[model samples]
Target: MRAADEQDYLDFATARVGALYRSASLLTTGDPHLAEDLVQETLGRMYVHWRHVSVADNPAAYAHTVLVRVFLSHRRRRSSAEQPTGALPEGVATEEDATLRLTLLDALARLGPRDRAVLVLRYWEDRSVEETARALRSSAGAVRTQSSRALGRLRSILGDSLPDLTRS
Candidate 1:
């Protein structure tokens, strides 16, 4: 890419970083540092593949797809154990809802990669089942089925703590 092209990409990446990192953090279970790494890798890969991606399409979505795949594939080659975002700073204490969040995370981590990916794409990214199916190389029926099962599993794991319709 030319110098002007690099500068334009840099501007675009800067503008999208916060949103991308937030998505990454959610996917990474609030691990800011790994989310930062994921964001950086996604940006670098996007920069490399910019020529193939049409300017007419949504670059952010394209980059996000790449980020999610990279994270999933990276996790697949490793163990199921998840690391934290390192110890909190001096004044930071544990979250009041830590147990609940951990329960949810553990449940999510138990899902197969595609299953977990679908939940993130559906609930976290708010993608339609069709969009998620396309992204995950599956049929819409599969996305729907998997998402339903995943939600059932999470609800089972969280039980009463999951939430109540009666609660505000």
Candidate 2:
């Protein structure tokens, strides 16, 4: 690749790495190690396609899509069977209640990979149904259906504790 292209890719990666890592963390249900791995894999893939990606109308969106796809692909691997523990891991700080966050992440961890992906993309990433559909390589109708079902499952998993957990 040309120097200018390499520089552009470096700039883009530097700008977007934090956001990508955040998204990957959510997708991995707060597993920082796996999240870091996912973000690295996403950036590596993006670097390979940076020439085309940098010129896309929405490069950030493309990066997000790549992150989600990489996450889903990782989930499909045979070694993806390990589950997160109920308690949240230490060292990550947030203003939000840690109990609430841990509760939510625990619920998310119980979900199937596609269901978790749908919820994360639709609500966490705040993407449109069509955008999420494109990212997941599914129809908008499927996205909507999966989102609805996933949310219901989350609610079921959380049970009545959700309201209490969210209470300030």
Candidate 3:
């Protein structure tokens, strides 16, 4: 274990798993198993590229990118399976804060992958519009348009139940 061979990779994983799972949970609402799978896949990709990433940078952000790519590619390869209520774990199983969390997750799932990524990075990851644009490799103008349109779509999906998104 030389200094350059920094096992800080391991340190980062252990410290960040909770947040990563939370993000994955948001990304894959009804499927805890698939959420774990996506997080694992993202971790693996991150491990392979860890040399280029740094202790100072947000590894979670990089992992978010991997999750978005994996999620989008998975959708392209196979139609999303529809599991009935009986098949999915009860939303009641989620701890306190389930309501808004689940609502946001539903809104996120409704968005197209890139738009979803923008919102997730912007809100969950606490990135600025400029940082988000850089992360998504998009121009600031396009990012604003996409994020605005995405929230608008969420407003439509949730209507009176979620009018607050519309106010933005």
Name the top TM-score candidate.
Answer: 2
> Please, what is the whole-model Cα lDDT of each candidate in the order they appear?
0.76, 0.85, 0.70
Off by over 4 Å in 1: 79-103, 163-166
Q: In candidate 3, how many Å is residue 42 off?
A: 1.4
* Superposed model 3: Cα runs more than 4 Å off: 1-6, 79-99, 162-168
Backbone Cα, N, C clashes tallied per candidate: 0, 0, 0
lDDT of 2 by residue, 1-168 (tens): 789999999999999998998888788888888888999999999989988998899999899899988888888784748575443555756646677778888888888888888888898789999999999999999999999998898888888766554565
lDDT of 2: 0.85
TM-score per prediction, in order, is 0.79, 0.89, 0.73
Q: All candidates: CA RMSD in angstroms?
A: 3.3, 2.5, 4.3
lDDT of 3 by residue, 1-168 (tens): 345545787877777777877776655655678767887887787777787765537666777767767765665676655332223434465453566656666766667767777777787778889987877778889989998998899888877664366587
Number of clashes in model 3?
A: 0
Candidate that would win on lDDT: 2
